[model samples]
Target: MYKVPKLNNQGTEGLEYLYIDSNGNIETSKDHSKLINDPDGVLGNTLKPLLKLPTSMPKDFGFITYNDQPPPDDKGVTPSVNSKFGHSKGLVMMDKTTGVWLLHSVPKFPFKRDNNFYPTSGAAKAQTFICVTFKYAEFQKIGQHLLDIAAFPFESHFPADFHDQLKKAAIIKWNNREPGEKIQDLESDAGTQFKSIAKKLYKGKMSACWLESEDLT
Candidate 1:
């Protein structure tokens, strides 16, 4: 079953969904997180209506790139696996100290530094894009959870040895076991300090889809 619920912490709220049974087993379910895996369904239901946006793109937001943050030395030192993840398919906002998951969006270019917005492709109609935000102290757990289910063909399984190795790596990530990275970096892997951008983009007109019905883009 796919569930879309508003998770609240303090007075703020975030969009959270899962594929699970009453016992909280995600894989046993038939859908297996299908709602978010493919199409944009929550737009008319819980998300599009209640979505909020920031007045401006917060300074804390940045793309998690594949480029080595700090370039190598003159002798051309080798880079680690984590240092080359610049496939800028998405953007994020993070603040590790207090842990704020705020506005997150695939904003068009000129808004995000050196990032361009994706345009509608060949189809009968347009499409919608969205993102979610959350906050918590258990940042590592959230990261592992997302990684476990972040792939396609959701029902696929790996061999015993490979699965065991992956689980071990996940545990190491949860336990802050990195050779050349800091705890903050690992923690931010969960996007603990990201914000949403519903209000910033649509303001009070989310349902309108546009400024006026007669005016088409």
Candidate 2:
């Protein structure tokens, strides 16, 4: 099993859960109960102002989510397609300076863009995630990586002047595209350096090193 680092209020450089309180205060908390949880089986309509672009982002911003399983409508009818396409699930939100990419294993989540509710369906099982904060320039490579994986954006919004790769990623539809990979050395704003190997339909070795703490427990 992998060890998770201890979280604290001043800890912004390592693994930490971003929790927004009802008062719109963004804080890092180890208490799961303090985090928002939706016990009712319904999509929340409450708008999280804390997640607004002008509030959370330093400047102009945009976001997009790619998932194979579309959220069921109010009538409980799921949208269907003629062909089987991408199956990746993730969300990428960014601004002119920085961005957040959340890669998750949850399906039928994020039913709407206005709310920040965690679905009951996703809570049934332990979901895995790889959330990273990267500089705006790195998003260009990230957009290209999504295209290589043929991730279909079920929901997306971005400025016209933003990276062209991001626009292309928002409209991915075909699954017959050739497989590819893009390797890059990336450095976070916090000075953490790492290499990323994005692959599609290929077998390869995956490795990463986190030197933030000597003891990950």
Candidate 3:
């Protein structure tokens, strides 16, 4: 499994869950109930401001990522924008109506919402993540053309337009695609292949490193 790198805030380590109470006061607690469970703290304080960019899209977007696999298997390695944590991977989704881009990550916090102390063994993965947004159409073009990463687990896809020529091409491609059984055979190692391909993609102009800070707004 991937180990999310810890971050520091005002000298506090791994304090990303702190939230603001009413009256705009920063609040936290040692008992753990005070820990944040929603996305607002970061969104309201840090993100909303950067989203000032004008967008004609409906302002809708979301994220997609594969669930973690049980250990003792070759789980995939992802390159994180946070170099301190190395790299992480996830899917990117959009609402065509909205121009917002959501970075994806698996949310398996170390603590349960109700428990103040560590719980029993074999709980969810203790991973770290940052909640942020970006402008849509940031990437020049995206498609299955050579594993263009829209998300993991290979979710549903549809034709972006209803043009006759596009439809014909899609139908031909669909019929020519691998059979379902073939896809299942590859599923076991798909993530590993995805990671390898993503690395090679960075050599071209289609990729970005978190180190470079690809800002949309």
Candidate 4:
């Protein structure tokens, strides 16, 4: 079994549950009710503004069980993946805008990748990845909202056509293609298009740690 990490809120420590299985998947659990009443107090008021939506009774929420076993001797040490906690059975919150009843269990992991990895040729053995269960309606709504925000900038400075182009450029970048590949595979004009729009919309206003700030910059 994996150990549960301590959660701190304004110098107070809260109870948390850890569910781990033999295959190396780990998840943290917390009471959804506590989170709803004290969302700002818990997350240091960081997510208060973004969580403007009203709290609702979670139709579905619980912990996911999974195996947490390390790879065999020949496989070597696998890099750690970050953990995220939430009220929903899945790590994702039901509503991105106003779901204060959810708690996130973010872990310090060495690798930066989605929590899905399958052992291939080099591994000594095979392992099964755990899929988190969630309510259909809640998942769809949150997923769509996030897609809209990530694909299209909410700012008014960029035109609709420019936003669409920027979304395409972002998709290209997400695929980890080289500049030349992006140009050939995606929009041939992607090169100057994203640059021009980005320069105009975010002139001297971008920061590496935007989430750390009190307000959107």
Candidate 5:
């Protein structure tokens, strides 16, 4: 996935997605342990993979991926903008110590649970992503922000005793009313401080703010 187009390597700018294992080693190839697969569903042949973690992963590890468009293999369609759902796409993976959140603008991506595949449609257009790593406690605030935005998480795994807000955010749900704006103060592992502003989607009114520099003392 890190390969660059030879012709446009000079000016092309894009984000690369990589999988890091428990030992802090980057996985260059497909790791079966990280794949989500379910051949059977609640009824039969549903192919809905549970959001549980692989046996090889630590029990505390958890992840959640959501998108406005469901995976094609699921036989689902995207909701209209008029609907209450949030037009957002992203994934959040975390453990007890720290975690990362990846926000992107790709449709029908991350492919099916059966494999690691990217959609041609997504590649045909320009896409952007922002990834950040944060301390575990910040995820609760992140979860609250997701809830406010009415995020639709398609797959996730939050262990027992996990934060209530995170578990709630990791599933499909609607907000009772327009949620209020929120501000979060975060500190990354590198000791960088950040302030973020988030609000729900209402009448196409969506806004976000963050500090992109490390010059703050």
Candidate 6:
């Protein structure tokens, strides 16, 4: 005979089963406490060594590495653009107190058609880059109360101007609008006020780093 056990946590309940094999007979039972107590140990010991395996590069060389080599004369291929939109390039600031996810657009390559082209060899294409700076204390607070912060809505806490600029960027990036179409809709003072506020808030207490679209997506 086999018995099943119920897992209870506060008001939540779940059923789990265990198995036993003797001679040619096999029996299933519910005994999940060991699984809960030492799950990592059991899973880790059962899995084969993953770290020992060597990573292989992708066969699509052009996609992986974008050398300085010029694009072929194929009509489908397009040249890279050299325009920058903002000064804070790829800034992402998360507020622990308010649970806000703020991203800043810094100046970098201008929007252009066929921005996805890459070199056939060498380093990967620089898709997008952004830098962010945040106070150490704020970061610490975020770390200490991450769960609480995560529950907050991002748009409500951010500055109105910053939100507006981000919304514009989102529209352009997400809507697949043409460069000309997006340019016509740019605000006269897109990031000026937001930058001033960010500088005041972050000041010397922040660390700046860049994250590409790949990282964010």
Model 1 C-alpha lDDT per residue in residues 1-217, reported as the tens digit of each score: 2323223442211222333332455441124432332224332222221122332334332112112122232354533424212212232223332232222222121121211111121111222233344343333443333233221111111222322322332331433332221123233334445321111111243453436576575
List runs of model 3 lying over 4 Å from the truth. Answer: 1-63, 67-88, 97-125, 139-151, 154-197, 201-217
The 0-to-1 C-alpha lDDT of every candidate, in the order given, reads 0.27, 0.60, 0.28, 0.25, 0.60, 0.23
Tens-place lDDT per residue, model 4, 1-217, is: 1222233443323223344543566554353322212333333232333332222223232111111122222244542312211111112322322222222222211011112121222122211212232333333333332232222111111122322332332241333322111111111111211110111112255566734657765
Give the least accurate 10-residue stretch of model 3, judged by summed lDDT: 181-190
TM-score for predicted model 6 compared with the true structure = 0.18
lDDT per residue, candidate 5, 64-168, as tens digits? 777877565455655343356666788777888888776767777556554333454554345555557788988888888777766677777788877777888
> Model 3, residue 95: what's the lDDT?
43
Which prediction has more favorable lDDT, 4 or 6?
Answer: 4
> What's the lDDT for residue 52 in model 5?
30
Query: How many pairs of residues in model 2 come into backbone collision?
Result: 0
Which candidate do you rate higher for TM-score, 3 or 5? Answer: 5
Which sequence of candidate numbers ranks them by TM-score, best first?
2, 5, 3, 1, 4, 6
Better candidate by lDDT, 1 or 2: 2
Q: How well is each residue in 30-140 modelled by candidate 3, as lDDT tens digits?
A: 334332222243322332322232232233433222222211212433312221111333333344432222232433221221222122322233333333222333311
Q: How close is candidate 2 to the true structure, as a TM-score?
A: 0.63
Clashing residue pairs, backbone N/CA/C < 3 A, model 5 = none
Off by over 4 Å in 2: 1-32, 35-59, 73-77, 81-84, 174-178, 202-217
Better of 2 and 4 by TM-score: 2
Q: Which ten residues in a row have the lowest lDDT in candidate 5?
A: 35-44
Worst 10 residues of 4 by lDDT: 192-201
